[model samples]
Target: MPGKRRMAQSARAARCLGVRSRPGALALVACLMGVPEARAFDLFGLFGREEAPPAPRPDALPYAVRLQGVEDDDLLSALQDASTLYRLRGEPPPDGEGLLRRAEADATRLVDALWGYGYYSGTVAFRIEDVVLGGDAAARAAVRAAEATRNRRLVAVRISVEQGPLYRLRRIAVRDASGRPLDLPARLTRVGDDEPARSATVLAREARIIDQLRAQGHPFAKVVRREPVVDHADRAMDVAFTVDPGPKAALGAVAVRGTSSLDPAVVRSFIYAEPGDPYSPEAIAGIRRSVTRVEALGGVRVREGEALDPDGRLPVFVDITERAPNLLGVSARYSTVDGPGVRGYWANRNLFGGGESLRIDADLSYLGLGQDYYARRRKLAGIETNGLGGRLAATFVKPALFGTRNDLLAGAFIGREVQQSYLSDAAGGTVALRHRFSDTFSVQAGIEGQVGYARDVLGRVDYRLIGLPVSVSYDSTDNPLDPTRGIRLTASATPYPSFLGSDPGLFVAKAQGSTYYALDEDANTILAARLGFGSISGAGLAEIPASLRFFAGGGGSIRGYAYRTVGPIGPFQLPIGGRSLLEGSVEARIKITDTIGIVPFLDAGTAFASSLPDFDEPIRYAAGLGLRYYTGFGPIRVDLAVPLNPDKALKQPPVALYISIGQAF
Candidate 1:
C-alpha cells in the first residue's frame, strides 16, 4: 500500500513537470524520494489549491512617436534612434512602471547622443497622453491613467529636443604622463581648431598620438588620461590628452607556444623579426601572417611582454593552434561547351612535421556529352570523340626553406586531354623556388620537363621537352575568393631549349591583371575588370605542340565560344590554336540579397596567327549575365552567354551555358 501511494504521488508530480510516460515518472519520483530536501517540495500544491484559469497575456499597445523642435534632419533622426520608447513602442511594457523606466533611460541616451553630435547643451523632454513627464510620481500616474483608459485608440508619445549652438574646438593640447606639454607636429594631431567638437574626433586624435609614439620605438605607449573642458558662454570645447610613452625598446628573443605535433623550429622560421631590431607593430603583424600561411595552423596570436627585458628589448611570444593535418575534398563543374568534369583531392598539410604540404588530385572530364555533335560539325578524323579524359597530379610545398622567406615547390602530373582540336597524352614534372618579398609580392623560377604524344590536324607526333619558367605576381586584394577591392597582376615567361626537345623549341610570354572596386562601403556592389596578353615565338604554328599553343574561347576565356574553337581554322574547319592571344573583360557584381547576386559582363578577345596580337585582326566579342549563390567559402556561379558576332563560316552556337564556382576571373 505504501509503494502504491508513492507511485500515485509520483504520477501527480510528473504531470506537474509535464512528463508523459509512467516509467519516466517513476524514475524521477524514486530519485526525489531518496533525497532529504525533496520532502520540502509541495507535492499537493497543484491539487490542494483552488486555482483559477490563468489570464491571457495582453497584446502590445498601439502607439505613435512624434518628434518636435529639432529642425536639423540629422539630429532629429539621431534623437529618434536613441529613444528606446520610440524603438520599442509596439512591444508594450508589463505595466505603467515599466513604461516610466524606459522613458527615463531614453532621456539619458538622447542627451549622450546630442553630446556626440557637438550639442553639449541639448535638452530632451518626453510626454505621454498629453501629460509631460516631469517627476517620478507624476510620470508614473500619467502612464497608469493611460493604461486604464477604455478606448483602444492609439496612444500618443511625444519627444521634444532643444539643440543649443554647436560647440567648436577652441584648442587641443598633448602632454606627457607628468603633465608636461609635448610639442607634436600639427599634421600628426590632425583635429584642427574651429572644427566641430565631436567626441569621436577627440578620441581618434588621442589614439593617433599613441600610435605615432609606438611607431617611433615606444612599444609601451598608451593614453594615460583624456580631458575635455566645455565653456558654455563661448560655445567652445578644449581637449587635452596625456600619453605615456614607456621605454624605447627593441625586439627581444622570440618564443613559440601551443605546439603539439608541430615542430617549434619550423614555426620559428616563419618569424622575420630578429633580436635587437626596433620593436614594430608592423613587424608583429607580419609575423602573424607568416605563421597563418601554414595550412596546419588553425589560429595564431602574437603577444608582447608587459615589461621590457633586461637587454632593453620587448619579448615576443607567438601562440599557435594546430588543425587536423589531413583533408579530403571533391569538386564538380559543367558547361554546355566543355561538358562535365569532377575532381577529387587528398592533402596532408603537416606532412613530416616541417610545415610541408602535399596534395594529390585526380580529375575526369568529357563524358561524351556534345562530343559527337561537335565532331560531326567539325568533320574531324582520328580524334577520340565521346571518350573519357582524366589527369592525376601531385604537388608538394616546403615553407620557409633555408631559413628565408622562400618556399620550395614541386609537382608532377600525367593526363590525357581530349578537346575539339587536339587529343594528347602527357606526363610532366616541375621543381621551383618561390620567394616572397612581402605580403603582396612574390617571384618564382622553375625548371620543367615533359614527354607527350599528340594527334591533331597536323598529324601524330612524339615530343620530349624541357623549359625554364619564371613568373612574378602582386596581389593586394582583401579576399582571394570574393575580392571587393584592390588589384592583382601576374606575368610569366617560359623558354623551351631547342636542344632538349625533338623539334625547335619556342619562347612564350604572358601577362594578365584584374582590378576590383566596390561601389558601396559594405561591398554589396562591385566593378571588376581584367586584361590579358600572351605570345609565343621562335617556332612556326605547324611545328609547335598542339597542347602548348595559345587557344582562347571557353568558359574560362571568351565564355560564348566552345573550348579550343576560337583561333585560326585548320583542315576540316577545326581551330589549329594560335601564336598570340589578347582578352579583356568587365563585369558589375550586384548583390540582391545576402546569399544571391547578379552580374552583367562583357568579354572581348581573340587569338592571333602572328607572334604578337595584330591590331588589324577583328576581336571577338561576347556578352552574358551570371547568377551567384554566395556561400561561406565562395560563390557558386551560373552563366549564360552569347556571342555578339558569330562567324557564319565557323557555324558557332548562338549561346553557351557554364556552371562552376568562383567568379569568371
Candidate 2:
C-alpha cells in the first residue's frame, strides 16, 4: 500500500516539476529530519543559488589579524590566506568584519595564482571599512580599504631558467610562397639548440631573418615557435620556429607611362620583370637602374609608384614623367688604349614629333706608345694619333612596333680619324647598323675605311694606306645599367688594303666576350679574356701593310705590362713596346654594403713579336688588388698593379697605377 502511495506521490511530483523551488525550503526539511549541524548542507540553499549577500553594517566591530592560525610560520601563512575572512564570518559577526573577511578570501585566491610560478611568498591583508561615502560609494570605500591592506608583498620572486638558451635562426629557410628554396647562403641557420638561450636576442634574430627573406623574394615566409622544451637528460634546451612559407608571388606586370619619343614597351624591355616571375624588392629597385641607362637617350624621368593589383595578378605601374628634351653635354676622358678622349654631344629627341631623334657628337683621341728592348739593337718607339672624330646620327623609335612585340631603331654615323704610327699616318671613316632581336638579345654591325700618310722613324714621307674594318656585337641583359645577370659579346676585325707607299699591306683582327653569373643573393664574379694577332709582310697583292702591325700594351693589356708589349717579332734591339699580346683578369666582387663593394683580382698578360731580340721575349706579368666605387653611371675603378717580372732597364719600381670607368676589360 505504501509503495502505491509513494508512486502516486512521485507522479504528482513529476507533474509539479515546473514549479519553482522555494529558497531555504531545504533547510526546513533538514530541521524536520534533525540532521547534525556540522555535517548538514541545506539542499534548498544550494539549489536556490542565493543572491549576493547584503552589504555588512558600517559601524560593526572591525575584523582583527589575530584570526591568523598556527604559530608555525609556513602553516600560519597558508592558513592566514585560506581562512583570512572565514574567522570573522562566525555567528554574531563583527560589524563590517564579515565584509573585510570575504575581501581577504578573494585576495588570497588571486595571490595564490600569482605565486604558482615561483613567487613563493606573498601577503594578503585588508583594512577595516571607513564610514565615509554611502551606497555604492560606501562599498567601494570599504573595498579600497581592504585592498590597500591586502596588497601583495612579493617577498622574493625565486626564478630559475625555465627552459632557455634558445638558439634562434641566423636566417630563415628562405622559401617562396610556393615553398621553394631560394638561393640562400649554405651556412644560414634559423633554429638553435644552445643552452641558456637568450630569448630576446633569438626572437629579434628571427624577425631580422624573416625580413631578409622577404626582401630576397620570399614574401610570405613566417616563423612559429612551440613552448620551449628543456631537456634535462642532455642539459640543454631546444627552441624552434616552424616555417610557414607562403607562395612566392612574383611581379606580374611592370607598366610605365609618361613618354612621347620613347616607347613604353622599349622601356619595359630594359627593366627586370616579367609575368609569373618571383617578386623581389631588388627587382623593383631595378626600375631606377633601367631609367639611368638610357636617361641620356630620351628626356625621361621615372619613379616607383603604387602596386596596382596585390592579388598576385595584374601589373604594377611605375610612374614616369618625360621632360621635353632641350639639353647639351660635354666630357673628356683619357685611357691608355682609348687615348686622350674628348666627347661633346647635343640631342633633340622630340624634334618634329613622332619620337624622332636628332643627335650630333664629336669625339677626338690620340693613341701613342714608345718602348725600348734590352736584347735587340733596334730601338723603336712611335706616336699613333687619331683626330677629327665626329658623328651625325638620327633615329625614329616607336614604343609599339609592328603592333605586336618588338622595338626598332635605324641610325647612321660618319666619322674621320687621323692615326699616326712610328712609321705611318692613317685616316678613316665608319658607318653602322643596330637592331634589337628581343629583350634578351641584340645585334650591331658596322663598316669602316681609312687612308692616311706616314713618315717612318727616319722621317721619310710615304703615300697613304687604306683600311677596311668591320664588326658585329650582341648583348642580352634585363638591366643594362646594373646587369646582375647576362652576357655580352663583340667581334671586330680590320684589314689594310693598301700598304704605306710601296710597303706591304697589314692585317689586324680582334674579338671580345664578357659574362656575369650571380652566385647568391649578394655576390657575383666576372671572368674576361682577350686574344689578338696581326702581322706586316713586304709583298705585292698579299703584302702586309707596314703601318698596320699589331701590338698590345697600356691600360687594357696585362696590368703590370707596358703598352703594346706582347708579341713575337724577335731579335730586334729592345723596342720600347712588345708586339704580341695576351691578357686576362679574374675579378671577385663582394658586396659589403648596399652600395659598397671590394674586388680582389689577379691579372696576367704577355707580349711578344716574331724575330724579336734575345731579351725581347713577351713581357710576362701578374698583379693584384683593386677597389670599386659604384655610381649612377657605373662602377668607378682604382687599381694598383705590381709587376711580377721587373725589367732590367727600369730605374723605378714597376708598379702601375690606373683609374678608369667600368670594368678593365
Candidate 3:
C-alpha cells in the first residue's frame, strides 16, 4: 500500500511538471542518461516535430547512463576509450534494456581498463533502475504503473568507479640469452606509470627493441620473454624482457627454387648479400624489391634459412614465382588536339630466359573525329588525312648487364606524324644504358640516330640526325596517379655531333621538375607545381627543323593555346618552333570525396627564337579549373582554360576545353 501511494504521487508529479507529455526529452531528463540534471541542455532535439518512438510494451527502463567518481581525466578518458557501451552513447533509437545490458559489460571490463592507468584496486558499482525511483522495489512498482498507461519507460544506468591509486614507475629489464643483464637503451628498459598502460602499445615497442638488436648484426636475435608484474598494495608495476642475441652471422650460400624459364643467375645477380657480407634483413628487402621489379617476376620471398651453417654463416632462401614470359597490353586516351588515340604492345618479359626483356608497340593517334581543329587560318575538316598519325617501336632490355639495378636498352622505331603545321616521316635507333642508384634515383646515357623527311612551313626537307643524350632523374612522390608528397625531377642533355645532322651541331639540354605537398591531414588536398626549361646552343631557329625544336602550347603544355602554336610563326602564320623554351604550372588539387576532386590551375610558358631563353618573347599565361573523377585505373581529367592575353592570331576561342587522363604535367 505504501508503494502504491508513492507511485500515485510520482504520476501526479510527472503530470504537474508536464514531463509525461513531451515523450523523448522528458523521458531522457527523467532518466539522468541524457541532459544531466546539473548540466546545460541543447534545445535542438527538443524543438523538432518528429515524434519520439513509442516505448516498448514490455516493462523496460528508459535509456540513460551516468558515471560517478571518475575524476582523473586520463583515467576517465582511457576508461571510456576502452569501453563498448560508452561508444554507443549517441546511437539512435535509444533502448533502455540495451543500455542496461551494455552497462553490465562495461562493469565486467572495469579491471582490465583500469590496469593501464595503474589502478590496481579499481572497483565498479553498476546499477539500473526506473528513472523516478530511489530503490529497486520502488523502481519495479513504477514500471508496473507505466506499463498500465503505455507511456515512456525510461531507465537510468550508473557506473560508479573507485580508482584505488595511481601506480608508479618500475624497472624494465633486458637480459641476454645467458640470463645476464645487457645494456640496452635506458628508455627501453624503464618506463613511468603516469599514463595508462595499453598492452598493444607496450608490446609493439618490445618488437622494435629486438629489431634494433638484429640491425646491429645480431641476425638471430629473438625476444624470449615478456613479463609484466603488477603490485596492487604498493600500487606499482614492473616489466622485463629476455632477448637472445645469437651469433654474428654472414650470408653463407643461396638455395634457389621456382626457376624454369629464367636462369638462376638472373635472380642471384640481384641479391645484394655476398657470401661473407653481414646478414641484414634490410639489404635482403632491397634485393627483393629489385628482383620483383622485373615484369615477369611475382611473389618473391627472401629469408635466412633454418640455422646458421658450421662456418658461422646463414644460408639464404630465394623463392620467386615467374609470370608468363609474354604479355599483351593496350591503352587509350583522348584530348582536343589529337581527338582520341589507342596503343597496344606485346612484351616478352623473359626473352632469353635470362631476364632479358623485349617489347613491340604501335599506336595510332589524331583520329580527328571529335573536336574541330583551329590550326593556323584553316578550320580543318574532321578526320582529314593530314590529321592521322601512327608509330611502331621495338625495345630490348638486358637487366643486370653491368650490375644490379642496371640495364642495357636497344630500341628502333619508325613513325609518321601529322602535327600542327607539319607532316613528318621518321625512323630511329637508340642504344642506352640505365642504372638505378636507388628506388628514387636513376641515370641514363644513350646515343640515338634518325633519318627523317618533313614538310614544314619552310618546305620539304630531308635530314639525318644523331646525338648523345644523358639524363639523371629523381622521384620521391608517394603515388604516380595522385601525388601528395615529395618531388620529381628529370634533367637531360643532348649534344648533336658535327657529322650527325645539318643543324650546325647544336647541343640541347632541358630539365623538368615538379613538387607535391599535401595541405590536409587526410592528404586529399594538395598543392603542386612544375618548372621546365629547354635550350639549344650552336644552332639558329632556321637551322633546326621544326620537329626537333620546342613549342610550348598544347594539352600537355599551355592549355589555352593551340597545339604547337606558342612559338615563332612564319609568313604563312604556321608555327616554326623555337630554340629555347620555359614553362611553369601550378595547381590546387582539392578532393571533395574519395572519388571526386577539383583543381584550379595556372600555366605560363614561352618559346624563344634565341638559343637561350631570355624572356624576350611574349609569355603566354592561362588560368583554368578542372574536374577530376578519380578511379582505380587513373584520374579522368576535364579542364577549361582561357588565355590571359587574347589574340586573334590564336585562331581559336577565348576558352579551350580538354579531356584526357592523368595530371596535366
Candidate 4:
C-alpha cells in the first residue's frame, strides 16, 4: 500500500505540468523518478548531511527527457542547461495541469537552446503515453482531457529532442562610409568558414577591428554598424561590420594647456610624440609612467585635436596640474645581520621651474643595539672593524639640459664601511651626464674625486682616488626588483689617474650581466643566471686603495664565505684585494604560491692575483637554498649556504646565513 501511494503521488505531479516552464521542479522530479535510471536515490542525504525531500504519492505523474540523434556532448549539455524541465533541482511539485503548461513552453525554449550551439533548426516533441502532444491537434486534445481528471491518477510524459545541424560562418566583410572597402586591410578578425558562428565571438572580433584601425594612425575611427544574417537552409551565417576610419594623420604642433606657473617649453621637452611622427597609442599610454617618475605632477590628461589641419596633421594637447614643490619622506627597515636602518630625504621637484630637482638624502645604519653577530664573534686578527657602518649623500638633478634629452646629475657623499680585513672613511664629489636611448636603455659618464683614510692588514693610511667612470646598460625586465624575464647587462670602464697621496694610476674594466627566463607565461617558475668579471690594469691590487681593488664573497657572491674572503690570502690569514675577479651563479626559482617561493642555487668563481683570471689557483664554490616572500616592491630573500672547499687552516662556519631584498643574482 505504501509503495503504490508513493507512485501515485509522483505520477500526479508529472501530469499537472504545463506550458509555462517550471524547469527546476520538473528536472528534479525527472532525475529522481522519470529519467531512464535504475533505482538511484539520495537516502536521507546522509553523505551531504542533509535530508531528502518527500517522495511523490502513488497517484502523482512522472516525466522523462529522451534524446534522439544528438551525439554532440557540447550541444547535449547546452540543451540540458537551457531546458526548463532539465534545469529543475529539488523544487516544489506542480498543480494538476502544470505538466501540460510546461510542455507547451519547452517548444520555444528548445529552439533557443539549439541556436546557442549554432543550430538554428531543431525539433522538440512531447507526448503523454501514446498520445502525441506535438502539433497533432487531436492527440493534444486527448492528452489535455486525461490530465484534467479529477480523480488522482498516474501519468508519464516524454520530451523527445532532435538537435539539428550546426551552423557555421559562410562569409564576412567590413566596409567604410562610402560603401567601398577602405585602403586599410580588414585583417584583425578571422571569421573562418568552419568555426561555430557564436554571436559573442563575432562581436568581439568586430571590436578588435575598430581598435586596430584607430591605433594605426586613424584617430577618429568608428564602427557604425554590425550585421549578422543567418541562413537556416544551408546551416551558415554571414556577418559584417561597417566602419568609418577617418583620414590618416601625423603629429602636429604641441600645446601645453592648463599650466599657469611652470615653463610651457618644459612640457614639450617631455613629450616623445614629436611633430611629423605618426600618431601613437603607446605614447599616449606612457604618459602616466613619465609623469609619475618626476614626482612633479599631481594629475594630467592628454587631449588631441578633433580634426586634422590643412597640413594633414593632428595637433597634440596636454593639460597639466602641479603637485607640492617640496616633499619630505622617511623609511626604516630591520634585518638580523644588517641591523635596523633609517633613511630620510627632502626634495624640491620644481626648484628652478624647468623640471629641475634637488634632493638631500641621509641614511643611518646600525640603529638600536643590534650588531653583526657573526662578524663580531669571529673577527680575523688584522681586521679591527667588526660591524657594518653607515653612509650619507645628497644629489641635484637638472632635466632638459640645453634642450637635449639628457639629465645633468651632481652629487656628494660621505661614508664609513667595515670589510673583512679593512675599514674606510671616505668623502667624494661626482658630476655625471645620464642620457636615455629609450625607455629600457641608458648610458652614464661621470668624473668622481674622493679622499679616504683606511686601515687594513697593510695598516691605516690616507689615500686619494680619482677616476673617469663611464657605464652603459640595457635593462628590459618587467619588474625592477623581482624580474621573471628579460636580461640586464652593464659594462663599465673607469680610468683612475692617481694624484695626491696616491700610487700609480689604474684603469679598471668591469662587466656584469644577469638573465632570467620564465618556464611559463604565468612566470611562477624562473631560471636565473648571472656572470661578472673585473680587471685592474696599469697597477697591481696592492698599488690602489684596498677599498677600490677587486674582491668577492659576501651575500651577493659566494655566500658561504665572509665578505672579501674569496680572493688570494695575505697578511693575518685574511683575503687581500686582487687584480682580477670573476663570479657566476645559477638559480632555479620556484614559486610555491603568489606570495611565497623557493630557490636552489649554485655559485662558483674567485678573485685572482694576476691581471687576467688564472685557473691554476682553486676556484671557490658554494651551493645553497633560499626562501622568498614577495612584497609590493619585490621579493625578500633569506638564504642558507655551505662552502665546498673552506679554508682548512682556520675554524670555519659550515653554513652561512643571509637576508636581503630581491634575488641573489
Candidate 3 wrongly placed segments (more than 4 Å)? 1-110, 113-196, 204-256, 272-282, 304-316, 367-370, 376-385, 402-406, 435-443, 473-488, 500-504, 515-529, 559-563, 586-602, 622-665
lDDT of 4: 0.69
* Positional deviation of residue 490's Cα in model 1 after best superposition, in angstroms: 3.6
| lDDT for each residue of candidate 2 in 550-601, tens digit (9 for 90 to 100) | 4554566666555544433332322222333445566666666655667666
State the C-alpha lDDT per candidate: 0.77, 0.45, 0.70, 0.69
Least well predicted 10-residue stretch by lDDT in candidate 4: 13-22
Backbone clashes in each candidate structure, one number apiece?
0, 75, 7, 40
Candidate closest to the true structure, highest TM-score = 1
- Quick one: ranking by lDDT, best first? 1, 3, 4, 2
> Model 3 Cα displacement at 412 (Å)?
2.0
Cα RMSD of all models vs. native, in order, equals 14.7, 20.2, 12.1, 11.2
* TM-score of each model, paired residue for residue: 0.75, 0.50, 0.67, 0.68
Model 1 — TM-score against the truth?
0.75
Model 3 TM-score, 2 decimals: 0.67
Candidate 4: lDDT of 649? 59
- State the lDDT at 295 in candidate 1: 84
Q: Please write out the lDDT profile of model 1 over residues 63-94, one tens digit for every residue.
A: 55677888776566555555667556646666
User: What range of 10 consecutive residues in model 2 has the weakest lDDT sum?
Assistant: 153-162
Give the CA lDDT, 0 to 100, for residue 598 in model 4: 94
Q: What is the lDDT of candidate 1?
A: 0.77
